[model samples]
Target chain A: MRALPLIPLLLGGWLALPAHAADPADARIATLFNRLAQAEREQDFQGTFVYERNGIFSTHRIWHRVQDGKVIERLLQLDGLPQEVLRVDGKTQCVSGTLVAGVGNTPDSSGRLLDPLKLMSWYDIKTVGETRVAGREVDIVSLKPRDQHRYAFELHLDKDTGLPLKSLLINDKGQLLERFQFTGLNTQAVPTEQELKPSDNCKAVAQVPPQAAEALASWRSDWVPPGFELVKSYVRKDPQTKATVSSLMYDDGLARFSVFLESLDGESVTDTRAQLGPTVAVSRHLTTPKGDMMVTVVGEIPIGTAERIALSMRAQDVQTKQ
Target chain B: MSREALQESLSAVMDNEADELELRRVLSAVDDSETRATWSRYQVARAAMHKELLLPQLDIAAAVSAALADEAAPVKASRGPWRSLGRLAVAASVTVAVLAGVRLYNQDEISGVQLAAQQSAQQGVAVPQVQGPAVLAGYSESSEQATGPMANGVLQGQAGWDNQRLPGYLRQHAQEAALKGTESALPYARAASLENR
Candidate 1:
């Protein structure tokens, strides 16, 4: 009888020990993500990094400063066509290179804050290991997708400041799609105002009045990958084609894709799909009562998911009645 | 063996007309650095005659011979389904290696070759529909083309509807993502990379 009581105690201790060990690991991962998010908002650092994908590679120097609760950042390409972009408090102030016409017309939405708690549902975040990056000891955190809808990410965050020093996007087949790594960093020296100023060549972004809310309400997606939510919706008029394009942006905390719906106006265009490095674009044709519409999905997502999203779009009015 | 006889055997093997004895002679002498140099010189001369790109450093024959040598030993008594399966596995791995080698070789030339192949393909020169190695090679080539034209890191679409709108659409998506700024410099870097093209 005494031996039986001891057996139950031993079993209970074994189970409880695993549960205790797991909870702290989970909490530590969450804490690291939380620190990373806060570091972007509060920390002031400047560094030079190289970004590479299958076909393209470029080096850039970035100067980011936080003052009086506002973030000012400037990015300049070091080699080839000195492209520069300046943003104040996460809003684009100006850009040196040519952007698509009418891109800046949409009303600027405030930047989406990274929510680690929300991201946990879509990605299994874990501290896979540790390594050194840019002469700093770092922790390698892996964000593996729970589904095939998105790609996986390996992030190397600085141990002291929780700043990401290197990031890699890997596809399902374990092939690396893109890489962003900092070659040098300086966290102690704050970037001066002169360094953060935009060059004379930088042209200011043109702003237009926000379109009516109902403009975006005309279309809806019947199905989307789980955990994704509509983050922004807007309609803009194309200058050259004179077509009004409605765009809806969706995000699952980390991964994001945009669905664009434009009336074809009887133009006979074939369906097409293209992949640019880590980004995929799929265009599909849909026949409706009004006319033909071209639905395009573009983002850092799998081509299969983009195609599914393109096919899932429906006229909102028809959807609501059902 | 005399160097002259070995050279003749090497030439015969290169021409794929080697008899069994000549093939064995070349295989045995492949380990000698002098013989290997002679074989490489023969390959370079042959490639030059055919106007083919010469990867002179690639010693595929030696590598394959080494692999076969490693796999040559087996318990003769242990003959059954497992042995056949092992052979099948080896064949599959060899196929995979060839596929990977072809892919790496075609990366730079793919865009141009694909464009010509597409044009000829549309002209009714139907692509061969054979099984085995040819099918695998053809499938990979076509699939690479289907991803669209990426020449010198610049996304250049065939002139048509896609050419008109795809670049614009790409830029808009990238700019939008940069504006979102949720992931800090990543989206911006992606957008800037597009401009470099």
Candidate 2:
């Protein structure tokens, strides 16, 4: 009689397994995500978009053209300050004054497109339904964070072009943190060179080569949230303070954060925390055997995650000699 | 305990109506896999009824616990005094947005970056940034006057390395994110927002 009772329980457990099993719909969603990533670089489009966060809103115009695999893109802020950025062949050619200053003159390599497999590890990507954006039908996809370390994203991609028509960043409370939506879009033909050219007022930018590029071996975090990994590390000389600030960047595929450490040079400075839209900045003083330094964690992450990162910064004394 | 009783206690806890005894019961049972599963289901069902986008698998408890474990102990001694001061500084600097009817007149002197950066952000939402007590004392004069109207007024007269360096740091972070982030024009907008001032 006891064996008979256990039979149904065993059958129930077996039935529950398939709910966690890989479904065909999931594969289809992943394919859609990959297409979205690939479409950005491969497609040539011009569009007007508005980015809104908190209470500030701004409109921008983008002219992205690809010729013989060399991508040329120009972005201009339509509303305020006439800020413009022009990039040729994946490197920044110039930017409007007040946009970027004191940067070194080095060629920037093209950043890789978002990898669907990597993002899958951090977010539960799923197609929620369909919607309309910019007068075109779009498929709504939600990339919910697996943990609290990152925010969730809802992307509405054009069904015909796979270009993102609208994207939203939502906090754990489901409150909209930021919104990027295309007010208008054109997906056909490459933009003319004249349209891609920046205004004469656009100042040339200097790309400084990162100092700690070779051995980011100089600092390490004692603890990072699970699935997060160091993506890049470098040292930059402060133009105003003349301090060499070492920075380490980490990402959990879907979300990214950076830690900047700078020596105080005996100048008194208080720790500070500030949030601008989805970005949070936390500065904390750290005392190491070598000396006193200040660590700032800045990223589009939860305040708690930033705090933990600020606390986990450790000097890599073993590699100090280098 | 019966499943029905446990479920009732879970609901009560979620609704913030649980008594002391029920609270203890829920906390004690929180570690059990089945109880946790049940709790998650309740939360999802409730969220669905409310039409909220609730993630069924967001394990915030685990993330927070992990953060707690990683918190450094060395900063403990100096954190106490500065934390209180930090709150005061935050309060003094916060700009209360009078939502519907308040008109922002003549913000011409404010840079685009400054206006864009803090207008919606300075609502006293937070986590205290812990610095050395001595450092806080140095800026005590300016921080005391950090109240809404006086905030920028104080900063204008202040001649400190922070005033010179912080903008650079903010701009650097934003620009770097723009260059490195492959997402879209959002980073570009952010970098541009930093220049309005």
Fnat values, one per model, are 0.36, 0.15
In angstroms, the error of model 1 at B90 is: 11
- Residue-wise lDDT of candidate 1 within A154-243, one digit each (tens)? 999989989889999876655677899999989999999999999998999877566547556798888787778887777877888888
Clashing pairs in 2: A104-A206, A104-A207, A104-A208, A105-A207, A106-A207, B111-B197, B112-B196, B113-B196, B113-B197
Docking class of 1: incorrect
Stretches > 4 Å off in candidate 1: A1-22, A105-108, A320-322, B1-159
Evaluate residue B45 in candidate 2 and report its C-alpha lDDT on the 0 to 100 scale.
87
Error of 2 at B118 (Å): 20
DockQ of 2: 0.07
For each candidate, C-alpha RMSD in Å?
11.5, 21.8
Compute the lDDT for candidate 2: 0.67
Residue B71's lDDT in candidate 2: 86
Each candidate's interface RMSD: 8.1, 8.1
Against the true structure, whose lDDT is highest?
1
Error of 1 at A132 (Å): 0.8
